[model samples]
Target: MTTTTATAEATTATDVLIVGAGPTGLTLACTLARAGAAVRIIDKSPEPHRASRGKGLNQRSRELFDDLGAGAEAAAWGTERVTLRKYRDGVAIADTVAFGDRTPTPDTPYASGLLIPQWRTEEVLRRTLARYGVEPEFGRELTGFTQGADGVVATLADGRRIKAAYLVGCDGGRSPVRKALDVTFEGRTDTEECMVIGDVRVDGLDPAYWHQWFDEDAAVMLCPFRGSTHWQLQGMPERDADGRALPPSLESFQRLVDRCSRRTDIRLSDPTWFSVYRINVRMADRFRTGRVLLAGDAAHVHSIAGGLGMNTGIQDAFNLGWKLAYVVRGLASPGLLDTYEEERLPVAAWTLGLTEERLRAVTEGVKQAGVGTEAVVTDDVTTLGVGYSWSSLAWGGAKAGERAPDGPCGDGRLFDVFAGPHFTLLGFGRGSAQALAEAGEKCADRLRTCLVDDPTGHARRAYGIGEGEDALVLVRPDNHIALSAGADRGAEIADRLLRLGR
Candidate 1:
């Protein structure tokens, strides 16, 4: 039997209960609300985090931000690339660009990586979510919870009880929610390596260039963060004069800069935020149990290499958000929720391998005079190539489970049509419009139809449609290809849509 606290300080109910206020939780909460599901998010932190951690977003993540209505804000808050300048013993060793030049195609408008502090990104998301009248409840920590066959009852630190249809753990690496689920976080923590990272104000450093100084036994890097006067400082200390570990304070940071840069010209002061980061590589053995699930760092934690940690978490929330919303709204079967783990877990495992390789390459290069240690922002890191062709829900299309490529349709773009909480069907050539209209009419509230005649074949080319063959492409609310079929398969696609909620 479900229990409720009567005459308690507060008792609430919601469709989804999110247990963190970070980017992952915030993104999921906002997505759920936009999809017309009731959501409540809570955080243990009393105030918004001020640290400038996880300061990069790949191309795919930028597209997601655009879809979430925070794209313009994110673009305005970040720069494309901040060049990295490396120095050894006060002499310039190499200067390299962090991102490569990848030109935008018709199907891919956002083709480059973005650099924005994680705090600012969260601020944008939170501000957007506020427009929906949903805000994170601060100082409310999840103490424990119990799940029955029907729903979950979440308990908070302050004696409030919440009955939610589903609960999610977007809490960080040391997630209390993950622990309550009894899931093992299997991975290695590098006790041998530690880096002190913080946002600091320094004198005599150009804000345009990310500067790194590497000496025989000491290393320090300072990168300018956009929209702020502070630079993010990262350093590894060899040992103090007494052969002890260095303290994580402004004075010690100054010592690191002086020792590594071999100059007193640059001075460090006024550290606003700081943390000692030990590299950890781990993933939860299971992402879901009963009515509870995990996303972001609570599900998987990656090394800082390739800057995949935050971006992956943000994407994870995006992937699960629409599915959760659909299931909660009774528009889709509960089995849809199972696909969240099926799709995201393998991606997390792939990211772990990629980041591990990058970390190894960088460390090996650093040991060998920093010659080959330049971090390359490749296509893989941009995550444009990520696809799920193997998913069981995918069907009949040449690009099933692939990212629904954006293209020109009528006077606007494909994404503009895919925007909002609705699946989209695009049909091309003769008889396509009627077929798509018939299918779309069946799910009028949840589906939108678009037609492209493409007399000159631009739209057809962008969508990879061939000559003499009309095409039907179905895009999920998250902008991934769900099914692709010949124009004749419209009835078949409609049948599939009708079965979605069964």
Candidate 2:
């Protein structure tokens, strides 16, 4: 790893400076770079992390990835609907399918979850980011920085200085940016509980199912990864008699398997990465401070029980990316950036509560036959139901701040039209032509107008517009409804956008 920073001048610059190259930072960097913005991403680690901690991609995150052009790559490398087989005291007690298959509807294109290692997810995102000619700089650590009214000047550990209009901390839980800003990360850590998670190869373990062995006190699980020899292992440790925690190692893991599964014949080998993670449930009091902000684990951390940690961070990056792009491009108001925190903070809090509830539900009850783990893996956890209905940007329509659904358009899906770095105005029927024309004239550079004149009424029903009742729905670049109204509110729509920039 090269530690020497470029010494061109004291005022090195970019449009956005991102600290950390994990899933969150990579997604934000990709989004900004794809929008023709200059972005620089740096990570302290010498190379990419190879842990398989987070393995599930929910429906909403999948759609976001699909929009970002990384979803297909992810789907190509991921597995679908692996069943969970539960055991107790060496006997196969129950069989449950945690991720069942589901068909896509006109409104929802991705109805099923995909399981892949988090490191692989980052690989696909990094590949997409490379298409924009932006690669993450490793071995560059953020030592300190200062932000002002105009821009931010960040100092790296290698004695480099970077000047950028915006600085984001996608760094993990111990975020330097958040700490420097003194933003309160409110939460508690379960010192009594720790899980040994790792990726390893095991003999005598079937690759077809997610093997789980659980009892009243301890559990060990091995989940198979697609197209790979490694399986993700999760095991609760048996504390010593003095109440001291045991260190994580292959030997300890073998003991866990022996004690929980009674499988002395199974041999574990090629242990790649492992950690005894102390469960932390935390969220920053706020997500922004001036031009510097936080996304992903920098802003929030949750228990891994529901697999929402990485997915929520990805969603955070998606929500913040376009808003930051618009403001940086001078197409929108600075206050537009404020909506990132406003819209996502509630969702983060709700996720914390939901995950805590699900964690308790799944761990406290009897290890029953056919006990549904569906609550943790269903559409709710997929974040398909997440919306910004209460945000200030939402007005006039019943589904404002909600996700703009996909429908049949021309020869492709409606999402195909909403694929790039531009907002879309969907006008239903001939009555909306005037509104579309006026809005198009006002925001011609950043907005695209699409008129759906289908006789089958699929598009109308997709957005819940009644027959012959014209409506106008404006979708943001992140595929959320920004404004919705009748055909006559063209002036109001234009005025709202202008006010948002103010």
Candidate 3:
């Protein structure tokens, strides 16, 4: 795909202007660029973040990265299925395997989450974005913005101006774009609960396990990052006399480790990053206002118990990228963009509730039996079960609005056909030839049709189609099933695509 960036004197024009070049913004930029949309991504930070913030990726996020062409590099730099080792009073207690007894299947290839530092994940995304001839403009910050009927005009901190058909905030929780829109972030912050988190180099510890030490009053976890010497530390913070958490430092972290493990032999030094983490569960009332929109942390933030923060944001970008591209290219009506919020907002709500429950369970389990951090790991956190069944675009079958399952397709797999920025029409069995031909006739430019050869019956079983039956399944660019129907409904499928474009 070919893309172009426009600039006129002091003002820059783009199809989408993304603020905050973190994983969310970078992912969005990459997605749009791949779809031939002119995009510009800017961040206030002078450079990429060095700290390991969100330290893992769920299975769904792994799939998104795979689709973006960064999966191989990420897997090379990441460690999967690290064992969780628990300790009590400096003595070993229990050892639990991550994603116990789960392995990759035909329909779901990514069976386990990956342990890679947040910085590494961002690095992978940045590299992918660079492949599209786009690089993030660091130190460029959005000061304010105003939207008109056609586009948004954004002012920067440096007095530069940007005009874009759409502006998305992939910014952090304290997003200026969302605030300028005056959207309410409805949730509570837990001031009483806090944890000190950072990346540090530690000696006298095995790099094999995610080490966790638990006691009655406090707990600490040190997870060794893959392909690095640094370990991400999370522990109960020391409080002052007024019951306020003190500032985090190297010495404070050492004390925390010693007190939590009841061991003085473990040595810690060279702290690269440190901060106090508070429980803040908040979601923006509206993900979009006029031409401005929000994704990632700007849209919703919840507990990090399930490591859903970064993954959710990456998925949000994937969901919005194709819709934005379609509208900008005039191939789809502007109303198509409304479905982004419609589909993602409910997922955000579900994520908040699920993570909150997990956090509460971990807290109570720690008090009862000194449960390890592995207690938080469940199949739900993998995010493979998450779907948009309630979405307006979902229709005709049980699989609609759900993720398109991967399966055998002749020499390769189903994902190989869904790898690009185009919709896929899967015609199951010979009877679907008419439906495939009709859909191809109407949406040939934006759609790819495949007559699935299911000799092993894996594809049929995964998609809920009978062995000898035929069906037509339309999959969105983001790999979500849009609609499913019998093979005879060829014209109906074509009509749906035409209506969407209109």
The prediction achieving the highest lDDT against the true structure is 3
Predicted structure 3, TM vs. truth? 0.96
lDDT of 2 by residue, 318-432 (tens): 9999888888888788889988999999999999998898888776553654453444665578788799998887865857898888888877878888988888898887889
Report the error of model 2 at residue 51, Å.
0.9
Please write out the lDDT profile of model 3 over residues 362-433, one tens digit for every residue.
877766553677668888898898888988888668599999999999999999899989999999989899
- Report lDDT (CA) for all predictions: 0.84, 0.85, 0.88
Ranking by TM-score: 3, 2, 1
TM-score of each: 0.94, 0.95, 0.96
* Model 2 TM-score on a 0 to 1 scale: 0.95
Best by TM-score: 3
Give candidate 1's root-mean-square deviation (CA, Å): 2.9
User: Which consecutive 10 residues in model 3 have the weakest lDDT in total?
Assistant: 1-10
* Evaluation by lDDT, superior candidate among 1 and 3: 3
Model 1 over residues 1-502: C-alpha lDDT tens digits?
Answer: 1223323333338899999999999989889999999999999999898888999888898988888899999999898866788887678777777654567777898867788888998999999899888999999988888777668888788888898889999999999889888899999998767888998988998888888876667788998878788889999854668665565888878878888888889987788997888889999999998789999999999788888889899889998999889888888888888888888899999999999988887776665554433554556888888877777667756788988887777777888888878888988777687888899878886788888645666657766778767789898888889987888888888887767745
| Model 1 weakest 10-residue run by lDDT | 1-10
Q: How far is candidate 3 from the true structure (C-alpha RMSD, Å)?
A: 3.6
